[model samples]
Target: MNPAPDPELALEVLTDLVRTDLEACNRLIVERMQSPVALIPQLAAHLVAAGGKRIRPLLTLAAARLCGHRGQRHVALAACVEFIHTATLLHDDVVDESALRRGAPSANAVFGNKPSVLVGDFLFARAFQIMVADGSLRVLDILATASATIAEGEVLQLVTQNDTATTEEQYLQVIEGKTAALFAAATEVGAVVAERPQAEAEAMREYGHCLGVAFQLVDDALDYSASQAALGKTVGDDFREGKITLPVLLAFATADETERGFWRRVLEERDQSESDLDRAIGLMQARGTLQATITRAREYGARALEALSIFPDGAERRALAGIVEFCIARAR
Candidate 1:
């Protein structure tokens, strides 16, 4: 029998399968990101040229192909999805005061925060222009709502940050808004523009949403997993930033009085010593909270696979399922 699918190979295959369409999308992204004001394009290019897996736009392209779309609109729409995602990244780095992204200096670090924010705004406007050009009101509505939801997610994250009292449900809500909303929009719009049935569109949305949640869950777990080089960020970013992630939440839930007080001091009080992150990892491991977080991520991965059951068996479906595996495997 064939061995279990290699998650990395699956993603590489998916990238190759949609390469032609991805090239078209890239061209459109380049065209749209250009501005008469030199600084706008320069700052935007700083982030856009950074290497990434380009998963969001790939989802759009793959979903359109999965739905058997015969038009060229998917290319532009995929670029639009990318613009939204990139804009969010710029804004996020500024808010998080992040220095690195995709293993390189973040746009906000290279360009000032003001320029990063303004360029992010430009990307948002460009995304809307592409959507309007597509002339699909349903697509517009879906992506527009996702933009607002992302903002809400960011705000919710801000409120929950440094608050050890944040619940798992609340944390899920934040990720659903910030990350999964765009994923849902990217895939759902592919179906929408393909003129697929509403039920199929909804299924695509659910698939993307579940996949995105699993993706974020793994990211959160990895923050404390001592694999920051693979993650392309500092190992203790979430901890230092006092973002209450799943592992921390689970750890706090089961901590003894002393450990509970420790969490409160480090996270709630934002008072961390140099050794705090090492201690945090030790606590999470001893308590199996990191493993538990991975288990939770796998649960979402399973749901993501389930959502794709509505689609017929095909390479696209298999690759999509493989993405779920890849997300969970990252934490392992």
Candidate 2:
């Protein structure tokens, strides 16, 4: 039997791969932003300058390298991935009325909602232009489809917001569309550009879908568990906005009418107290909702690793698998 793969070997490969991608991100972004339109350059630079984990771009780069691609298109594709992500964030902050992101004021907050939205449009156009430059109709198709799905997901989430009756399954579908769709496209496009085999390409897409699901799971968990200092946004911000995330949904499912009423009042009326947030947390803890939510994340992580079998065992495959571990490890 091939013994279980050592995580350390995976970690080493993942760390090195991610580091190389991050190092190259700034230069590549700048080089690509030399548009004739000055505003496009300015807006793209502003969003790119606001540092993120660069996880999406790294996923593309690493997947390409894993599939044996050694071309400059990987760099441009990575930048396109990040541009799409940033554009979503800019629009999200506007819709959510969010004040903070990644430890800084959201673009909407700093530059006003008008500029933020317009700049977001600029990024989207540039992303499309970059994809066109790649000369791959397949890549453009995946990204365009993912972009539409993300937009639809955002609207779906808006409809669900402040509706206490939003089911867990509904929530999952929304997240899969809004979050996992882009992640799936990012890695899958990498494989496609590398001319990977059909089975391997499908596996890479599944890998990204599962990783994205796991990553969003921990984002919900952290809202309840982490401090404002760590989260860079207010703790319980979801509750404040009446966004019923996974943990809360799980807890509410088992909650009695009184507890349900409590949530209804908070969500529908937006009339929450410190005590409301505290009691909600208490109930979730007592009922093991956090643990239950974590269970779901682990299941997704397992599926992500399971999707890697199509790729032959190698450092690239190891690193791709390690990313799943990183996602789940965030909760612990």
Candidate 3:
């Protein structure tokens, strides 16, 4: 048997395997992102060409391939998935008032929020056009619903943000709608376009959902542990923004009276001093909450791996499993 692939290289290997289809997907993405209004394409291209890893689109392509699909439609569908994700990123940066994305100034920062939001609307419209062109109601329904769900998730997060009382269940609900919904749609549509059996399609959906949750959890942890270069943005951004991530949730759940006061001051009241982020990290470490979040990530990663067992063993399957490893290993 081939030696287990390094988690770090899993995405590279999968990219190599799916290079042709991905290239087609890229072409489709560029073509669709264009507008008679030059500024739209210019701003959209700025974000798209920035290094994003294209993991969601890759999942769609890999899922189609895993289900033995040999069609061209998956390429366009993968591009559609990517456009939805990119649109969200543009909108999210504006919503968060973020300065940087993918290690560069965010589009909203350089282009202004109005243009960024409009261009994001253009991308969303373009994504639907592609879905319609594919001419499958099932694909349209899946992606359309995911789009609505993502909006709901973002609104829900807004409601929960800076609220110290946000529960773990509520946090999971937010991530599920914002992140995992698209992931599940991306993979499930691959099987739908492939005409796979219902069981296999459901398996793909579960796999993507689990992987997405694990991916977001790792991102939350990395906001504390990773370097600026590793994260492609400033560390402690979530803390600075007063976002209540899993680590913060776990820490608050176990805090004493003094710790609870500190959390409320920072998270709820948004009253923070320069030293607060460091103290927050210290508290999380002392409470083992960061590790606890990572441990929860591992559980989801295992669920992702289990979901893949329904597929026949092959390079595609193995590479997908490596994605799970890579998502969790980033925490280490």
Encode model 1's per-residue lDDT on 1-332: one tens digit a residue: 12128976767877888999999988888888888899988888787788778899999999998988988999999999999999999999999999999888999888889999989998999999989989988899999999999999999999999999899899999999999999999999888888999999999999899888888888988899847679887778999999998999999999999999999999999899999999999999999988987888888878878878888788778777777787678776
Tens-digit lDDT track of model 3 for 1-332? 23146888888988988999999999989998988999999999999878789999999999999999999999999999999999999999999999989899999999999998998898999999998988999999999999999999899889999998999999999899899999999999988889999999999999999999999999999999888888887788898888888999999999999999999999999999999999999999999999998999999998989999988899989888888888888887
TM-score of 2: 0.92
CA displacement after TM-score superposition, residue 44 of candidate 1 (Å): 1.2
C-alpha RMSD of each candidate structure in angstroms = 1.5, 2.6, 1.2
Q: Pick by lDDT: which candidate is best?
A: 3
Give each model a TM-score. 0.98, 0.92, 0.98
Extract clashing residue pairs from model 3: none
Candidate 2 runs further than 4 Å off: 1-15, 18-22, 34-43
Residue pairs with backbone atoms closer than 3 Å in model 1 (clashes) = none
Q: Estimate every model's Cα lDDT from 0 to 1.
A: 0.89, 0.82, 0.91
Q: List candidate 1 stretches off by more than 4 Å.
A: 1-4
Give the better candidate number (1 or 2) by TM-score.
1
Candidate 2 scores a C-alpha RMSD against the true structure in Å of: 2.6
lDDT of 2 by residue, 1-332 (tens): 12125543544556576576656765767787667877667766666676676778888988888888877687788888888988899899889898988777777777788878987887788889988988899899989999999998888888888887899888998889889999999899889989988887898899999989888887888888877766776678888888878888888889999988987888778988768888878888988988888889989988888887777787777778877776666666
For all candidates, the clash counts are 0, 0, 0
What is the TM-score (0 to 1) of candidate 1? 0.98
